[model samples]
Target: MSFPHVTIEGYPRVGANRELKKALEAYWAGKIDEAAFTSTAHSLRIDTYRRLRDLGLTEDYAIPADVAYYDQVLETALTVGVLQAGTLDEEFTLCRGNADTAPLEMTKWFDTNYHYLVPEVADQAFEPNPERILTIVREAADADVKVRPFLVGPVTLLALAKGENPLARLDELVDAYAAVLAALAADGVEWVQVAEPALVADLVPADAELAALAGTAWTKLLNVDNRPNVLITTPYGSLREGLKALADAQPEALHVSLAPSVLAEDPTYVDRVLEAVHPETTLVAGLIDGHNVWAANLRERAEILDKLQAGHPDVAVSTSVSLLHVPHTVTAESNIPVDVAGWLAFADEKITEAVALANRDEDAFARADRAVRTRAESERTRNAEVAARVAKLPEGQVQREPQFEGRKEAQAELGLPKLPTTTIGSFPQTQEIRKARADHRAGTITDAQYTEAMKNEVAEVVKLQEDLGLDVLVHGEPERNDMVQYFSEQMDGFISTDNGWVQSYGSRCVRPPIVIGDVSRPEAMTVEWAKYAQSLTDKPVKGMLTGPVTILAWSFKRDDVPVSVSADQIALALADEVADLEEAGIDIIQIDEPALRELLPLRKDARPEYLDWSIRSFRLVAVDAEPTTQIHTHLCYSEFGEIIDAVAALDADVTSIEAARSKMELLTDLNEGFHSDIGPGVWDIHSPRVPSVDELTELLTAALKHVPAERLWVNPDCGLKTRGYAETNESLKNLVEARDRVVASL
Candidate 1:
């Protein structure tokens, strides 16, 4: 049984896809020419393969084909013509202004906070991506490692494609995928794992299209001549509806998650899965902790495996999902205590755990079992302190200063615009800016040199904003690498990584710092940047900072502390920064807590306390300022309808939310009772697919239906840093034009 056991599931340190992000940014900055950008990307591809081999865990390698202009995997599929394109010339021309150069449309990847390039489908142009797969395999061969490269399965591709009715598109896409697989078989690649992860979504509960897409793709994949063994991966949860279809298709294997939640919910879910799977189909049991930072107990894992073994002795144990969700290594996190470090497992450690389980070395596993037990015992000692802290939370600690009316009265005295337009506080973080900062950190450049470069970037950003006629200008964040990370590095309580990379969305990754101890701001956080920007621009410069909830969400939070406690500590630090920014005469400080939605407790019972603390923390940070300070908060892709009260409780003067692509449905609730000022997005800027003035005009019109036109602040869905300068310029021009047209009509 060459069923080489491997686990893949870990959080990213920084952005979603780091190398690809670097390439795109380099290309945008013209630091390296197009050829050089492409060449460096090729080098990153080689580096990824080498890293996988260096780790010594290779049953599979997630190739960088999906890391592309929009997204790598999906882009490769589109470039090779797996999906059918419709009205391409028209939509392309509308979005990019050039039908000849209409790049594929990319959007957010379902709900998991990642984005992938959309597959452009066209029947006349179908070609197998042989070179991509071959190149990956050759890299593996060069490293002397046997591996299976990953591809987006047809079902998931079909589900995410652009069309009115995605279900109808599945039939043709299946055959396209089959042709691609057949070509791979001809190229002598005998094993591949098609990921059908979307089967775990809430939509899959009722959608039959998911099943049909899976069945069609798998049937074709197996039917290919001399094909590789196919392993269908459905991580996160059991494929509730598509299980039977997946079972019937019955390729070489079926991978199901055995994460803590999955195991606790229903032994029946797995039992049914094992029963439905064909006897020939091997069950790839995900036996390690892939999501959390805790080291897995071999004994606990063994017990779960024993249950699986009771049903089928031939079960293979692996990770719950790809290790791409977790940090790369815990080695460089110097701030975390060594004792705690031993109890935790990052991506690299999870790989070793998967190997031990799969190899069936009971004796070796027993030692790991004992080590985990010892660590757990030590952790048990700290539980009392954690419990004590939770019990001692003061009633006043969770409350804020004053009501919205009082704050608003004070804010009015400061004088700000009614329909104030602002950005989420970022300017183009160019290479020259980053290099100067890096050089300063390394002592190759003086503080004066670095600050001067940043000042120049800020001045340019201010000039751009004045030219564009934006109401509130940002300092362009030239001095900061990341919002949370920059602050974390400056403060004493946090620790960061040299090479710790985590995927944010697509190929853009961020190395979030680890908050290991009590967090306190030793000095002012963003006062210099805020003050300097204010100096350059007469227009109100919005001081930007990631809110407490976001810092907690983005960082590798300590398990020893409740999130509420960590949030408070961060809030205390940010509150100081907020005060300093206010003192510096900065109006419209936008505290972005985008991760607030992401950090919502998965279960309902535990949600209120989270909201109570999360909201109080936001208030703690912002409420201290006078009402006229214009305490703005920006959130994206958040469903705040249910938590409208909590949203109100934040007491922000303004909240810019994502509503453009998602049909402005959030406005329905906001219209009914939302008290605070709100600025819903008029168009999505994240996608390269630009909105037309008419499209945005209609969107703004709809936005005006819920929000008063006087209060409306037209802006893009999120930051435009990732977008090309050309696209950004064109899109903003359209947005401003649409706003003007709407205002004229009103």
Candidate 2:
């Protein structure tokens, strides 16, 4: 069969909404049988396919099985390949023996937080499971929807797989994957998309051997008897190599991302790939930004698509990346003014974009073009007001009453114990905690009841720390759904969605609130919780606040205003909270800015302005505190090697950062320039598996190599909210044991 002219190019069908999540939860809980679960899951796929089918879209099928236990499709690939280390298998195997058994660890997919399950190919007997793909195909078929199943391409899978030398088995693995493709073909799914996003990675795959491997994978997959059309999709980054092989192998179609920055390029990459491709090959052009809320430049994108089509008139339009990067729907953003809302395009709106571009009808194109115009106008209005407000900030708000030295003395007098043990400001949020919040949201429990529940958790956390012999205590942010979302909900300038869930990695979804106005604290945000928790123990309590840069980075901010303005507004609000906490006698505060590094300007030239605003915003919040207040900050998923100086510039009294998994590669950078006290996390928190006391002792020993033992604190890589109680408790016990060992050795 000929490849259809109508192809839909986006993400999977599974949504992070309440209904879908409940069904999956029930399935996991064994409350529903496989048949019942599969039925519910299939309905979602059918609904997605039907929606796109009604609009005449086809290239990609809305398959639910592509979504997995962990939201990462690559993780699904790993599971299919049976790539588990023996130890991991053993740990998960005895889950009933140890209720705190951590699940498989997932690491960042390249530099992005989109995590992929760490594939442990300890042996060579790994086999592909056709049932995974077949399940999706069968579901689509039952729904009467013609679907092309999607898989993370062999190259990408190999890139994400874990081993001493993952690249070593690339050829053999690609061959195995080709065989899997053949199987999918025989199953009557004619079309398949092998996503090789690793093509965009820094390692250029232009070598002859590399090209040969890519060619081998494509030709073998495409050569399957009665195979469906094969489409190679690569997005998020440009293909630096393999273009010639890709064109030469000549799958049914070729897809390339058309981001604003990429579109503005010399167009040479597109032209070369297009020119080199077989004349019969179709081109899928990405015409809309996926990761941001900025309205699509319809005229500009349409013009680019038109230009690309001038060469290959069979060009099809799609989003630059998955709509998963965008919010689920705009309808949930109730607080945004209707005029402003009109300027936005959520996932549903972007689907409309795909259909509009497929028709190439100028009239339909004009409506999108008008959306951009209205968006631009709205932005102009917003920027003018925001800029004026920023220009008039009271000068004192940006400066401290007393400088670092003066404040440091007061903090020391508070007599915090040396080598303090503290958490990253959250304890395990159990099923009970989640239910309480759910009940509150559903009105089954009152706000007061929810507060009491959260307070009880905080009180328990305080008691636990005292029992555990920790120095600094945290309020265990159980009341918050997400670090950024919680603050945004309370602040004056943000709007949250009930169903705006976007996958953070897999089943873990974060509904980052949308910041819409000048940020201001309506009242003291954390004083009550901080004070209550402090009252529970004589131990100094750390008041937790998400830093300005993080709140700006994590939330969907108004592009109409410069990020600096938005950040400053957030900083000002946080500044008020910091003052309130200090007045309420909270002696320690930790401002977490985990997303700061993620938000660094992609271009090197643009970084100074970003850093200036980012650092200023952090300082604006912290400078108001007396140095005696013991200001601490936490950074995550960031390699501080390049910007170590910038990190130091923030002058936080102490900072905790991810170090366990990073292998202390960043320690030397800190040793050279960092002046503040530091806590290089002694253990990896992302993994559910607990580290042994010996493992932590080694980690702490290595940490002391770069940082002085006296200046060091101990903590986990991140908050423990996602972890179960057993893992958290056991891990902390090991951490304390390791510390004691280190102390004894000294």
All models: lDDT? 0.67, 0.71
lDDT of 2 at 60: 42
The alpha-carbon lDDT assigned to residue 37 of candidate 1 equals 64
Can you write out model 1's per-residue Cα lDDT over 1-746, one digit (the tens) per residue?
Answer: 33444544322323224656676566555676768766666666556555655555555532222233334345446534663334423322322335356455545544344555555443334555555556666665675654565677767766666655554656566666676667667766666667777776644324466676667667766776666677777776666657888878877778887876556644577778767877778777877856556677776787778777777746777788766667767775675666657766777777767776766668747767765666546633343443454345455434434566666666665454545566666655666877998899899999888788888888887887777777777887877777778778876556666666666554466576766656777789788888888898777888888899988777777644566777877777788898888888887788888877676653344567788888877877875676567788888755667776667667687788887867788888764446677888876765677789999888888888788865677777777656655676667677777777887788
TM-score of each: 0.75, 0.82
Candidate 2, 1-746: lDDT as tens digits: 55555454565344535445666567657798767866776676667667666655654443212444344444345434644323323422322124555445565554344555555555576577666667777777876776777777776676556667666676667656766676777786767776777665543333445556677767766665556677787777566456777777788887777777555442577777667767788877767667666566567676777778788857767767766577666776676677667667787777666667667767766776786677666543444444565677764325454655566566678776556788998899899999999999899998889899998888888888888888888989988887887898888767766667766654456677777657777788889999999888898999999999888777887755577788888887888899999899998899998877777653344578778888888888887687678899998876777787778878788889888887777787874558778898877887688999999888888888888876788888889988988888889888887888888887
Per-residue lDDT for 177 in model 1?
A: 67
